[model samples]
Target: MSNPTLDLIRAHGSCRRYRPDDVSNEMIESIVEAGQRASTSSNMQAYSVVAVTDAAKRAELARLCGQQKHIAQAPVFLAWCADLARLDRACQLRELEQSSEHVENFLVAAVDAAIVAQNAALAAQSLGLGICYIGSIRNNPREVIQLLELPRLVFPVTGMTIGWPEKPPRTRPRLGLEAVLHRERYNPNQDEALLAYDREMAATGIYEGRQVEIPGRPGEMEAYGWLEHSARRVAQPMRTFLREVLEEQGFLLK
Candidate 1:
């Protein structure tokens, strides 16, 4: 009961190492065209992608994204933006005032951007290209805004690097469906499923070499598993300045 698309999706893995080949503009446009076909809320299409190919700019962007070498090496770096400025322009053209301050609007735009980027990623993969999503683009939002020349109501949601794969990363395991899927009503009791998945992931040795040490209690755990790694990630404070950055981008959380 599987098809090409489904098989492709299941086989998906992030490509961190890429060959030095370039992704042509024609190929990029075709991929984006596929993205443009993705469903959008109210057909608002509140997203824009900025493709950065300039070596210097890509280097700078890689630096801004915590020195991710893949981003610097990839031939193309796309900045997916939640763009409400175009909608605002539409209102201006109609001589009507547009309000982008609502939190709902912000959410809508972000969701739109993410959906489109996923479509684009699949399209690239279909063409035998590789991609890696870079959420670290939000690390220096203000500088990114300036570098990309994004106007008000436009926020960089994420970035993606696309190129020919030098080597593809191993397929990562996902949690069992029992942990996430529930019929009819919500099920809060999933400890057993979680623990089982933790054991399964531990067996794969995914975090064998790169284990995050739990602060104040280093080397307490003999074998680090998915639970411990994810717990550490969730416990840490991340992107606390996003609210202020969103405000500066003219998106009001209220």
Candidate 2:
């Protein structure tokens, strides 16, 4: 089947380098409008996107996001947020109690935010713009909350940098369908698929000329394959403070 949308998705890659040219306001508005068209939980629309364009703010955001230069250089930096604050305010106006602190509510808001952000990314890509998602925005969640002036019941979910691409990047390899898809029931046997994918990725030179040393193991190293890289990533605690941050934001209360 010939499908332009699937083809575009398959060819998509994270854009780290971008041209100095700005994405026009009309395009940004269209992109965000596309995002707004995405389905929301109970039509609550619990997501908000903070568009940051100021040079000084971008620099601070880049610093907060682990010094990712692309964030500062991108023409647009959008801070996607899971927001229940507006719902709470709505409840207040009607003299109704707000249950925004529930874990289910948090999940709903986060999922809504992610779906909308992906829609916006796809819209930007369709317009010849490139985007890179910055999960490192959680590195300093408190700072991000303060910087964006997020109220209670609102939390920064992720950041995205969007701009005109300076150059096209090679499409990265992904796990085969067998590794991710199940017919009738869940499959627990993924070792074979994972190993095959690791080999395929290594052969593609995706992580070529890079050294990924095993933590706490000196002199005993192996090829930095996808399995090794991903294993190392999960071996240690990443974003351990997220729970605390969410709790502070009046969420995840079961």
Candidate 3:
């Protein structure tokens, strides 16, 4: 059976290079509408998307996003924000205190934003557009918040660059289903699967000639394979200040 949706998802890949063509406003609106149609937590829809088309703003955003040139070149840059500020305004209108300061609310907002952004990405893919998610926006969330004029109870979760691809990107590999799917109970014996996946990934030339910094060993370097690359990323604190930033945003107040 040919499942178009599954096929589309299976063929997904991040596109960094795009054509110089512009995405029509109508297409952008339709994509965002698809995003809005995603399931929301408690129907709160605690998320917002800011579309940046200005050249200067995109340049600034690219700098904030670890100086990624693709962000600046993309026709549309969408910042997906976990936004509870609107909910707070809604509470004020009803003369009720906002409860978005709790950890649960923050989780809900972040999840909502992620789900919505995925929906938008799928829609864009269906329209023959390519997209790449920029998680590096978290490297300096404070600056991104300031640049986007984000209020309290709102923070950028991720950004997406969308446009017509200059060329089809190579599909990246993923872990086997057995590695992630647990039936009756959680399976602890994952080493074999991990090792097998590591070999398979090593055969691919995707990370060839790339240098990766291992955690706890500052000057130490390693070949960029999936296992080592991912391990290094998880071994250290990528965003140590996120908790403090969330606290400043009135989240994680228990």
Top model by lDDT, which number?
1
- The reply for model 1, stretches above 4 Å from the true place, is 209-220
lDDT: worst 10-residue window of model 2: 206-215
Please list the C-alpha lDDT of all candidates, in the order they appear: 0.92, 0.91, 0.91
For every model shown, the clashing-pair count is 0, 0, 0
- Cα error, residue 59 of model 3, in Å, equals 0.7
TM-score of each prediction: 0.94, 0.94, 0.92
> Which of 1 and 2 is ahead in TM-score?
1
Candidate 1 C-alpha lDDT tens digits along 1-254? 69999988887899999999899999999999999999999999999999999999999999999999999999999999999999999999999998788889999999999999999999999999999999999999999999999999999999999999997656888988988999999999999988888778878977774455555886754457888888879999999999999999899878
TM-score of 3: 0.92
* Whole-model lDDT, model 2: 0.91
C-alpha lDDT (0 to 100) for residue 40 of candidate 1: 100
Candidate 3, residue 189: lDDT: 86
Q: Which pairs in model 2 have colliding backbones?
A: none
Q: By TM-score, who's the top model here?
A: 1
